[model samples]
Target: MKIFNLPLSESTFEKRAPFYGRLSATIEDMRGKTKLVLRLLLLFVAKHEIEATNWKIIALWGMG
Candidate 1:
């Protein structure tokens, strides 16, 4: 992830298998605890990869 818009690490972009499975678990966890709008906003701002190909990130608070 990027720190102050500076390049961070290459390992951060490493492939993660079964992406949907892990993602589903997280969604279930936040289903009732957090509102949908808030969750979407958080996800949008917290972990944005400006350069998708490079997997560079601009994580603020990160995933819940």
Candidate 2:
């Protein structure tokens, strides 16, 4: 007959595994979201500048 015994106490790393995983996941998500927002903001600014430049050109043409 073979007898097996499970661990009665958690190791230090095991005890902290969930906390570390959550922290790492949160950081990764935040970094991805930040990058996405920054890209969107940059695109919006570029679009706004293009529209403003077009308006300026139209105004200049009207004056000439």
For every candidate, C-alpha RMSD to the true structure in Å: 23.2, 9.3
Error of 2 at 59 (Å): 0.9
| Backbone clashes counted, model 1 | 0
Candidate 2: Cα lDDT at 48: 100
Each model's lDDT: 0.58, 0.89
Runs off by more than 4 Å, candidate 1:
1-17, 35-64
lDDT of 1 by residue, 1-64 (tens): 7534422455443344356468778998887667877888887866564355245333432532
Please provide TM-scores, in order, for all candidate models, with all chains considered together: 0.25, 0.72
Ten contiguous residues with the weakest lDDT in model 2? 1-10
Point to the candidate with the largest TM-score: 2
Model 2 agreement with the true structure over 1-64: per-residue lDDT tens digits: 6364434567866877788799899999999999999999999999999999999999999999
Off by over 4 Å in 2: 1-10
- Could you tell me which residue pairs clash in candidate 1? none
Worst 10 residues of 1 by lDDT: 55-64
